[model samples]
Target: MPVPPPPADLTTIAHALQERLGPARWFDAHTHIGQHDPDGMTATAEEILAGLDHAGHERALTFAMHEPDGYRQANDVVLEASRASDGRLLPLARIAPGAPGALEEARRCLDAGALGFKLHPRSDAFALTHPDVDAVVALAAERRGPVLFHAGRGIPQLSEAAVALAERHPGARLILAHAAVSDLGLLAEPAARLPNLFFDTSWWHPSDLLQLFATVPPGQILYASDMPYGPGTFSAFAFLRCCAAVGIPDDAVREMVGAQLDRVVTGADPVDLGRAVGSARLGERSLPLERVASYTAVAMQLGYRGVDATEAVALARCGAQTTGTGPEAELLRYVDGLLARAEERLAAAADDDAPARMAAVLDAVVAGFLAATTSAGVPPVAL
Candidate 1:
């Protein structure tokens, strides 16, 4: 394939973004930050802030998992990180509907300066569409804060009903995290009918962003990086490129993607870390490209491999290419080549074992790209 000329003054765009926003103030709409697994990115409060800073995020609103063994500890960690960032971090608390102190804890999170609540029906063990879940939404409405929910396929009906609840409460904010292309179709009705509903862009394919911009209003969108879930900041950068590609002008990108998150960032009050749990934060003492690689390797173990991951990472590195030549460009070509190879492999892999092997190879290719691109700090090419 013939290489297209590089986008005009891409370096100037990066420099402008770095200067204007001081690392682009990404409000990570949904991240499992408070989980204290020793194997996870699992770092201290100070470490989480430094990592966010290094990743170019000004702030992130994090949520705790709703499972028992460590639920309260997770909330404690999110609280601590929010405090340590001096409001640069926004905390989102988790409430498993039937948990012993679910309601009381959610209310306390509001009092403790949590910006919102996050509900994961699969992990939390309840339907977001359930009557009990309605009480949670009502509480958020009563408190004047937002609620973020997991919305996607093969999950419970709560994702849809949650939209209905948001429609019912116009004053309350309802964020659909990881708004996929399928989600765009699912959310269109409720979002169009309801002004308070918002969508978060995290670890999604770049194509989904294009679909969304063509369909939804710019103001209804928000930028997020599911950090240390880690493709590094490439996830956020891809969103920017997608916005730019779709003729969502730079100012609008900065406004809806950057400034809107910044507005949410500034509203956060720090958690009192002295009394909060320390285990829920990222354990990194400092930022290192290797740390990012290590964390992403875990996601690899989680069986989340896909061709889009490689393409998205490649596109990000392309955007960061200042000279439009050198190794970054070479890597872009490699990714393009790999996609061609993957398609061929997919077709030829008639046996189950062959398909699995091909998928594993693709996953490794993605991992290698992620490691190299992040270390280089080169933005990705627009797909």
Candidate 2:
């Protein structure tokens, strides 16, 4: 299946929606500032800032990536970046719980101005139940700081392990990165049971976010891009799509986007910022809608046809409802029409290759829409 170009009117509607949302302040709760992996994942503070700027995020809680020396140097770099960022960047010291002097290192970083700490059990090769991890959690609890754990689809750092750890230190604010990635459903009960446990939106699947929003209290969820490692722009879009799909209230959306995290870090009351509507501001940031449209156009030009584009169209229509206006209703109908056409094309297509190709194109279009809406620079197309 080839990707079809989005209609010009569709692009215009997307832009209009972007403009209506206005400039939102996003605080990415999970981001890394250093490169320490064999997969060539590396980002400097400058690059991290650039990504943040592109995404219209005002601040991020960043930490060092995995390092060979127990993140000693990486922690220093994060501290330095945070010091120089004028509060735009908040440092979260990374610690290998099993390493010697880990607790002391965490204390030093906290005293040096780190707002929280991050632990990656998978990368550090330690279980969450380790005594060292307990010690780190204890320290964070004593200081009333947040601890972000890399809990996803794995043995040692699964959502269950995270729940057990959170249970031990009920006072500590523990964030489960990637929304517990593959185990959102399993963690829903624990998420509700543990008040100090929070989840971040960083995974690519919009469904996961939708489930999280639907199953968990809105206040317990935080907006995060996992920038410099994950697709920051796309992650933001996925979050938006989730909110739209779930019909999350505007005030709740605001809190999930940044306010909740702000309160956690600053101990301030969650301000009730009104809905993001009306005309856009001059020079305000926007997602890369044109790039997405162009990519879709190129895919269609290549003779691709599939149901994936139809699904994306449906998702966009759902997103239109978030605005709750007549114009948005009309836009939804327009997108529905496009979806019907795409479905017809998909039904008529005979080639088996169309599904995969169309899926890739739809994914790109969604990512592009996300980037365009938020004025976050578009990431390179995977296809």
Candidate 3:
């Protein structure tokens, strides 16, 4: 197979990690593929397929992006795309749990070949306290299909209700997307006890991923790329590196990457991969990379909030410009190369809003951050 390209190139780093990790099938448990999202993000089925191919993934479970005007049409679009994807794309009905006919819509899509359901309480503006949420989760439970919840950002503390639903319907495969960072600190302990509750690794940020792997059972963590938000190639790169950093065995890494998600979506019971690997297993740390992660995280957040991230980006640049030599310095210089590329893209943007350009900058920051993550294990060859 041909090697995928850089600036967030995976060849050198992934080669080492994959050699150690052995072979594993990748099932991307979370992805968004659509043309019209109110958020200005668009990903066609072809784009998602290319990403899966680039990452050497077998298939991806996808739903519509934020469809504010109801998801009936959006759901249909996804279903049609999946039907033609030759098993490479799996469609999930994006639903507003509180909306009228939500259950009916879910039933329709499920009967029409949807693998599961996607609920974004923040985007849909439901509190999860809505009476319909339980009904929807119960439906998933009855069908043995996975019910993925948006746990990235926004929204209030929702684990209480989620816990209640998971307990009530033992079969409901509950997935908290985006590393479940909204409540990761609070849910780590609870997640250990709830076998059916899972988290999707669809985020950037090394420490956040480090924490998730250290706290949650590997069985409950699934590989996912928020496609269009983040590409599968980078996700696979960072994920494998983190797994190696935490001293997680290749067997557990195999399940975390894809095996377990396949079972959940197919309405099959999930396999137990034993307990979490303690943080002690996390090998040597690089303060430089840690600072690089910090600055990039801030820059990306500022960009998302529609604020100028120039200062943060500059700080990130500074963080990546380490002096002297060795592993830490070498890694910083590699990330610095990627960061410079992001700045170049940002500088070339002359549009007033520069939405597309801004996305490019932020996406570059994500790439730089994740590329830094690979430094946690084997020092990545300079790109």
Candidate 4:
């Protein structure tokens, strides 16, 4: 089935807000400029520059994709591109903790004017708290730049592990990319506790971004697209829509969009970390149509098996109701209902291990839904 378009008013508002903010003040904290993946996804420095131009961004932190032969050559590509761009692009080197000479390579990149480092624990198949990863974080601490970690939906480098590492290395500016895309609530307390830990809004989920903005301090959030790898234009547009829909203050939105990142890259006094502005205080604007669509898509994509026709119809009905109400309260109730049904099903499962596994998935879904709904100014409803 074809996806529906967002409401015209919502799109207009998002574009108007984007225009008001202007691109010069925006800095994409995460992006890549090389070929690496088997699917042949590649982005050249010029293409990245054009993307930034199209997005109205003045600068971006650019890095190379993870190369199979290690990132030595890839790092060289990023350095050359940044040098050629004359500072329009800031370079970060991608490092595999388990790779040979990873520490030495990191030091070399830093010396060669690389601004920071990017680590993907899932791709590298290493633990976030591994000694070698610590070595890289220590390197970033010395350089006084951020260490961006890919944290979501993968093994060994979950947000909790990243939080532990950030706690251990107080001096390192650790950025949890994708806002810990899957388990953002898990990072809330850690983000509040660790002044050095930061979050980048780069994932596709609006609910996660809204929760992060509501839960984490403004200073701890950075705007990022993960562009050329993820959809560049869509990501930026979605971010703007989220800011508008959530009614974030203009000044705070400005910081999340770019200013705070400018300070971080320049080694200036860090933006002051403040207490979280809870969802109720943030704003109670109606959820945008695009966001409702996002929520429905996620619900339909839930991997639960044995979803009978009756359950599917109920889920669809809830989705339709959410669209009509345009209120997060309705969506929250829908998710709560789904969770209740999942629990009842698990209770009757014949296999013990099946129940345990299903329970884990349901638990994650419930946590995410509650976080999003709470941030959207909807009180939790008992299941």
Best by TM-score: 3
Worst 10 contiguous positions by lDDT, candidate 3: 1-10
Ranking by TM-score: 3, 4, 2, 1
Candidate models: Cα lDDT each: 0.53, 0.63, 0.77, 0.66
Instruction: In angstroms, give how far residue 252 of model 1 lies from its true place.
Output: 1.3
Residue-level lDDT tens digits of model 1 in 351-375: 4442343343333334333333332
For model 4, the stretches where C-alpha displacement exceeds 4 angstroms are: 1-14, 22-24, 281-383
Error of 3 at 337 (Å): 4.1
User: How high is each candidate's TM-score?
Assistant: 0.65, 0.69, 0.88, 0.73
TM-score of 1: 0.65
Poorest lDDT segment (10 consecutive residues) of candidate 4: 1-10
Local lDDT at 14 for model 1: 35
How big is the positional error of residue 148 in model 3, measured in Å on the Cα after superposition? Answer: 0.4
Model 2: lDDT equals: 0.63
Which residue runs does candidate 3 get wrong by more than 4 Å? 1-20, 283-286, 302-311, 320-326, 340-375
Task: Give the per-residue lDDT of model 3 (tens digit) for 1-383.
Answer: 11113233344554555566778888998888777677777888888888787677889999998877889999999999999999888899998987889999989998999877999998889987787888888888888889999997775867787788888988889999988888888887888898989999988777788888888888999998888776677677778877766777888889888889889998888899988887876556666666767887877777666666667767777877666787666666777776776676566655555454555455455545554455353344555
Give the worst 10-residue stretch by lDDT in candidate 1: 1-10
Global local distance difference test of model 4 = 0.66
Q: lDDT per residue, candidate 2, 103-150, as tens digits? A: 889989988888878998877889877888888888887777889988
